[model samples]
Target: MVGPIGNKFAPIGDPGRQAYEDSLQVFEEVIQAACQQVGIEPVRADQIAVAGEITDQVFRHLIEDDVVIADVSGGNPNVMYELGLRHTTGKLTIQIGEFGQLPFDVNTIRTIQFSRSPRGLIDARNQLERALQVGLLEGPDLLAVTRIFREAQEGAADIELSTPDVTVETSDDDAPGLLDTMDDVERRLAAMADNADEIAAAIEIIGAVTESAGSEVQKAAQSGASNSVRLSLVAKYASDIREPVEKLESQSSEFAEHMESINDGVLALLKMIQSSSPEDRPEGWEAFLDQLISMAESSREGMEGLNTFGSAAEGLGSLSRQLRGPGRKINAAVNNMRKAIATIDSWDRAARSIRKPSEV
Candidate 1:
């Protein structure tokens, strides 16, 4: 299918006009070559009809055709959705993409990757011919497709399995007894609570800094600085401070939710340990065990949220430093903030580990 490459090409904007035209020209040539390679007479028209009706036409053709070749080079959402519909109909579908342009979700799929060069196009045509011989007439080989998918999944599994496990040692003499471990967990929970408070304080500080910087920019503009100079200063201020402020605002609710989940988990773990006994045990050891399980679950969720926040914070800091230019006090300050966030992430992980209960 062709045309309506992407929304970026929907309007005749200066940035994309030439590139869009070039891509369409290339796509038409590729399709013509593909048709000939499969022993089908190439459509006489060099140009494929480009209009709103193309999508409907393609869908109807897909329903009738024994095989469908989809070009997903531009990552067009509409094309991807239509391709998905083709898959649902159980037709033999061959996916093709430009080199280095595949979407993450379908990167593992058995796709024909092609470069934009003449040699690459020839190679892709040959491959498509072979695929058509095997795929179209045979009505799609389920076993081959299954094997391709299984290998991809197994490669991902292998990466997870290869990750090194972390082990912590305790002294045999002053080894952390159950009680000691429990105490440590409590201390870590308290520290996490303190860290959450610190995050809130840092956000407030960032807001204040932004406000002060804005005021300074206004004064600089009014102090007879050139309009160009004032504009540059304002841009720098936005580039340096806006992201951190925005990110802090965006993540506030998420951070609060994570902290609340962690707090609840810690409290439940403490109660479970405190109420344990040989007889007349806690009313619901099984239920209490479930709470411990939830503790791990919630801790993981909270950590993931924090990790996201950390990444945002790091990007904000990096952008801030870049805006401030080199060898400046503001650049140094942003770098320090980045390092502080990194340290917080490390300490947060350690705290969570300490709070995690031993497996029964």
Candidate 2:
């Protein structure tokens, strides 16, 4: 536990003394009680028995704790600083605050909010227990800042897969850092779903044109200049599908990102539903679970199609020199798409893991 230790609980006057006492009550009754219920030992930095620099102790606690319960009440600068540092580790972090007092910057992230009343404290305890249970089951909640590092790691994996047996040489060390915001990345991913249809259509156009043109080119190669005019006419169609090639190039990365987005959303929803009290859950949650599982299964078909199309493009490129350039471009787009889809297979397992609190 980390928060509101120095200035916050310091006895400045009668009012401040009462506030400090009340803070102690909340810690004992709400936070520590929840930890005991979850069978976990709760530790606070100020209560540490070991002698060391306070900063080192706090940092060790924040980094090494199996779980960190952070109280953001009164927006204590020290607490906020510690919380920021904790977030960097992407460890199990549970944020709680006096009701309505969560820092504005982090208000949207999942937090256990509680009133100062006795009843509110009880509710907070129950909620925290459930959160810890669900967190242990699902691992840490994926924060956007921490998520960027994972995404970069996945990008490195993409580079390796794109080059087949060869070691891919790319500087992911310089890859753009934490996205502008999750909302922007999510919005771009949403656009990716729409682009998938367009890309599919473009793939068809390119595939159909290549196959028909390849037959002529094959005959021309066999019989010599007799089929030159036919080759010229058929070859022009590749240029006609230039727009499609460009679309695939532009949108394949976005297309793959949608899969990752879905993976994140699906897991988040699963955790939310699993952690929530029965009264708080939406109707038809079971149906939603089924749908999420189905979505994961459905994604595989698209992945298979794109992969097959990529291989087909490679094959067609060999059939005619005219198609070699465009085939390579489309194949590269396939690499981008595969990169996004590659890491999202976790959603399949996540989908299967969905179960009620009783089952857990």
Candidate 3:
């Protein structure tokens, strides 16, 4: 088995550098424990002759190994990248991470999440033993593995395929009457509203975490650390920033889904309102009509908001381009701008052509 420790040793300044070293120590102990649990000899770096750095030769050797045990803690980019390479080789690979450190995207993939406590380490080792057993036998379903190896290397138990349940409490007075019936559009719009609320709340939480992380990193930098310490801290800050930003982007995508559902609901509501005769209208039909109109307006507004957020995200893409230097930045910027403009144009068309109930 090959265990890559590139990210654990990656240059981040003083405190973070020390933290990374400590993490590596913990990683080594855990790996040995896990191997013992599985009845395998714990392989050390010196024994395996693997370099700490992520050289192409090291990566090639890892890919050629019979099995891979990767530590994905701290969102280690190089480790993740190599793990991905290992997956492409269609070998047995096991994933583990520090508790709560797994990326949202990778959380669905079965992983052993460890804590600092001895009991936690033992539990993680047990889990890893089970994973290795299964992985050794099955080889990770070659055909079903993700193009992204890290995703593919995820064990079955870790994948989250469905959304969590949303609970909304209503007082007797606020509950709808037994006789009330909602058309598809009204029902869909209500659902979209609930989803939007959830997404908004998630965004707020992620933003708060990102802000706090940034502040901590800034403080660390200001304390006059050594080069290794500073680099490590900066790298960690970058990784920390990446997580919440990714969550925010994902929530934004969910908002887009909400917008689409609302649009569908509005169109459906408009059609229902247009088709119904005065005799067929319910007792509070006028109220329903007013609500439908309001909902349509809200949907349009929500789409605008989503578009704006998307634009801001697109702006971040420009930063990535600029960091890469001149010629590359222009192409990336152009491509990004083109996509942004296209999305805006599509939203413009959607907004302008949304049929009013009266028109329908």
Most TM-score-accurate candidate: 2
Worst 10 residues of 3 by lDDT: 158-167
Candidate number achieving the greatest lDDT relative to the actual structure: 2
Q: Positional deviation of 276 in candidate 3, in angstroms?
A: 32
lDDT digits (tens) for residues 1-360 of candidate 1: 432343344568654665466456445666656667677643211233656565466677666676667777767676677666666566677777777776643443456667888887776676666667657566763322344345665673331111334233457886655455445544554554444454455455555665776687788877887867766765666566555544443344344344444443344343443344435443443443443344334434333333323323323333444443321332233323332333233333333443445542
Q: Supply candidate 1's per-residue lDDT for 291.
A: 38
How large an RMSD does model 1 have? Answer: 17.7
Native-vs-model 2 lDDT? 0.66
TM-score of each: 0.36, 0.44, 0.38
Provide the lDDT at 22 for model 3: 50
lDDT of 2 at 95: 86
Q: Which regions of candidate 2 fall more than 4 Å away from where they truly are?
A: 7-19, 149-360
Between candidates 2 and 3, name the one with more favorable TM-score: 2
